[model samples]
Target: MRIKQISVSGLFGIFDHVIPLNMDERITIIHGPNGFGKTAILRILNSFFNSQYSELRAIPFKHFCLGFDDNTSIEIIKNTDNSEEAEKNNIVFKFYQPYSEPVYFYLKPRKIRSDRGFPMMFLDYGIEERHTPIIRSLDIRTEETLFSEEAVEHFNNLSFPNLKSQEEPNWLEQLQSNIHIRLIESQRLLNFVPNRSSRRSAETPSILSTVSAYSDELAKLMQDKFKEYGTISQSLDRTFPVRVVKQQPSTDLTDEQLRHQLNELEATRSRLIEVGLLDKDEDAEFQIQPQDIDESTKNALSVYVQDVEKKLSVFAEIASKIDLLRKIINNKFAYSYKEINFSKEKGFVVTTSYGSSLSNSKTLLPTDLSSGEQHELVLLYELLFKVQPNSLVLIDEPELSLHVGWQVQFLKDLQDITQLADLNILMATHSPDIIQDRWDLTVELKGPHK
Candidate 1:
């Protein structure tokens, strides 16, 4: 799944533009002047491939076509007003007008021949601003936005092309489907694209902290794998003191299920200020306090806090999986992992031994490592361990923490890894060191008009 070309129009700062890509190289680079929409091109491709049109809401579009290696295309023409001509090609994407309640993904799934339409399944749909109206995992069919779940199943049920054995970018997410939209899109690549998750992964030293940060930032609230893992179990209830979750007067419910119940409640003083369908303020204790609130309200708050604790443990379980220091030292790091241990009695110190000879061992915390070594370990570890092959990796800027010499070798290191695993990299870089000698693969997005 290679993108051969893309053209965009009818958005701010971007005039008519078309990018005819040469994806023959395993590594592709996009370079342009300061304000030349280099990042915009990456964003456009990211949204297009993921079937996310939230960015295109209420905006008029002249033409947007995504060309593929198979000579097939996925087109987007906004504000169609039911035009018969545009309908001939079929609009694969649409957005809810005004960005109001119940934000929608209007995919016009159809039963047709080859090269006419595209199949899409998304891992993350950015709708947090709309408060997220939870919809079923299956197809959504409305008057303006309609599609049959059956059609989608039939599409994916078709034969898929055999996957190539080449290496790919590591952020590919595996989604179950009948359709063949196998390529993955992620906003994170080596902390270069400093989205919420990247910053968390970089700052958090231990695996437990890192996983918690990932889950919290992404808010993947309903994962169940944590239940099977006891590394973050309820035994902490006695070991750790009960700490109250911070509360706002505006927030009245602690249960996630109860939050939905609160949303359905009318904002009336009749009265309600919480997440429960029950006619009581679940957070009455936090809101009204010991002397002011009644017994029933305090009890409700107690029950709510317990539910919150159970839900929060899910985050702890996720954090437990993030400790890859040992894995990194074993794999990508220049040093070999002789032995590494964390001691609570020693004030939670990470000690590692690395060198050619066993007696040449050195013990040091992550803080003891140089900035370059730390950055290289974390970023390259994510590239090798966190990513899945055949992923379309997008890096905002690959030189954020490196020396000029390191910047020059960045592309070479990326190429080495990409070759080992079938991967594709499209990076937006300002540093010339990273772009030198890669002119054939570079596409400079001219600013303002081009």
Candidate 2:
């Protein structure tokens, strides 16, 4: 979708604004000096395209645009053959707002003939994705209606709740998981572990002492590779590789060898106890026999089993998508082409120009790749996602963690890809190097350009 015009009565410092986007150019650059409300422009455009529901969260009261008291109007649509007919466009978004008292926030492409009569045909571009019938998640089970309440409810109940009903179901699920994973991964879990000194207690290490202690401990842990040790612990706890043959302890074992022997033995004993090999009396307990189900409980059990089965089905479906995504990513970025390999352990692994794994060690993560490679991989995947022709693409901050040379080269390559895919990319960037040649479409952001 392309935006034709955007007008804001009051937003940020702007009292009244009108910006007509040129659709002929593939890219449109909003050039303004620092503190000239360039970022505000992007936000306005984003708010315009996004649902009113979304806008409320971003800036409530309809008249309030973040720091500004304003009413905003945006017009977006496919350019038709007849401009006169387009002027009388039927598009409208009207909905109820719990935040604002009494009535719904009314929006229409054209001024209504009468305030009393509201058009039903116009799409409701509420922040809630479910507000629009066209944008709602596809429900293959029901064809009678465009909007499936049952499907929506079922989707709402997913592990990842749908923030917007209009979003594709799988998209919501993946998005939730992605956000969860990112949050958990981004947390830099730092702590002070007191040194093994007699005077240094866990609770009372001084700031300087704590830093020194943590560094010493971290150094030793890194040298010993505690991550591998943790992996072993997890494997043992999970009973992975369920059975193992025990190797007899050697008579000439060293201290390290003895420690390994004891750990292995302890792990075996724990597994044996879990498997019902030993009771509290040091006697072996046989597996218990299955009990017969009663008629009443049998029906309940069946229902309970069905519920569990459904949960499992949801999990299996999500896992399948992740697996499929991983496989596709791997094949697409394999050594032969982009030289990026994907592993659940490594994420996206960038191979060296010499065809070696980017990480020197097998145990090291794929995220260990240089910033340039990571940015390239991110760009590659984002572009690859738009398979459909004439698809609208929204990219926030396209110039993330990349050198100027790479950014220029990447943009040049992306232009070629966009041509093939027939994709219209609406990218937000602060890089002059990337869009310098396409200056007409470049929008300078507020703040120091660097």
Candidate 3:
């Protein structure tokens, strides 16, 4: 269900571009001069799959098509005719598959009366000025635009009813369900969250808050895994004696094999403790002597090893993600004299190495980090913790706020993340440093003449 290719015609009424995703690499970079529609393409894909229809209607493109790996394609056609009647049924989505009839869906237009007066009270509202047909026809007191494109769209959906039912066809719905898309915009620092006390007003929180929240989330997740591990340990401990009594020793269960398994389990436990998933066991230093184990004891130890492995398996996925995050963050933060450590109580414990001579270190808050550091941490955390597996993540301006060194390393880090997270990345960037000799992965958006 992966999108193999993306094509758009008459983008900004000037350019047509075709972008083929590097399916094997599972990453695609789109680069071009400014206003060449790189971000718009990402937005269009996100808008279509995420059902943000307002964006689709706003972005100027005659036809936008997504070709899938399964030989199916979806084309969105916008009627360019300027007539009000034609504008009512402006957008049509067509889904095509080989050896099957193409399915068509019309985007139902929101009906707003022409004589409706613009609400003067919403003048102070932070809405953009792109007027849809519904808003354009409204009678206004002032010449200045009242709302942003997105704000206008939101208002229209709330104020007006559709001419017909807005229900999508089952096939279209199922097709959309199969593919997942996440857009990580360039403005990554601030989040507009609804005010808990009031629905209408919203609070803008910085990325610093996001990093702290993620830290707490990771802590909670680790605690939950520990609880699950404890439960599994108890369940296995209850059945251990019975299982050991019934166990039959075979020639395959060698002494060396048993010792190796025990050592591996200890190693796994040590790793878990290091990653903050488990508490350090002070009495965990005992090692089995080869001579001390008889046939009966070997059987019991084998069962014990299996049970421990089962318990530790619970931390496998989260441990890997956390370990990678630590490695990447610390590697970069090292240059800034900072270090990141994790704990069950604290999501991220950041300390500065500046006071080494005084034998004292300051524990800085997440917000204490520089803008670039915050950007790096927030972006990585979102990739590792927030996004689901096998999703298409559209990152706009990944090079934002990153140092040139960080920018150079961005692609490599992203490659590592894509492999670990099982994601397909399609990012737009202006920095050649971010591309860093991997121009082979890029799709350049050129003008009609170029």
Number of the predicted model whose TM-score against the real structure is largest? 3
User: After superposition, which runs of candidate 2 have C-alpha atoms over 4 Å from their true positions?
Assistant: 15-18, 31-54, 60-338, 341-349, 353-364, 386-388, 443-450
Lowest-lDDT window of 10 residues in candidate 3? 156-165
- Residue pairs of candidate 2 with colliding backbone atoms: 28-441, 29-441, 29-442, 30-443, 53-127, 54-127, 63-70, 129-166, 130-165, 130-166
lDDT of 3 by residue, 1-450 (tens): 899999999999999999999999999999999999999999888777766677787789999999999999999999999998888789999999999999899997644334445453332222223421222211245433433342355443222322112578888878877998888888777643322221233233223366667777888988888888888878988998899989887668898888788778778878887888877862253345556667768887877777878988999999999999999999999998899988888888898877566356779888789989988998998898888999999999988999899999999999999999999999999999999889999999998875
Candidate 3 global TM-score? 0.85
Per-residue accuracy of model 1 over 304-347 as CA lDDT, tens digit each: 44544453445342233223333333343333353432221221
**Candidate with the larger lDDT of 1 and 3:** 3
Among the numbered candidates, top lDDT falls to 3
Q: Report, for every candidate in turn, its global Cα lDDT versus the true structure.
A: 0.44, 0.37, 0.79
Task: Supply candidate 2's per-residue lDDT for 133.
Answer: 25
Q: How many angstroms is residue 17 displaced in model 1 relative to the true structure, after the best TM-score fit?
A: 3.2
Preferred candidate (lDDT higher): 1 or 2: 1
lDDT for 350 in candidate 1 is: 37
What candidate 3 gets wrong by more than 4 Å, as runs, is: 111-165, 195-208, 282-292, 355-358
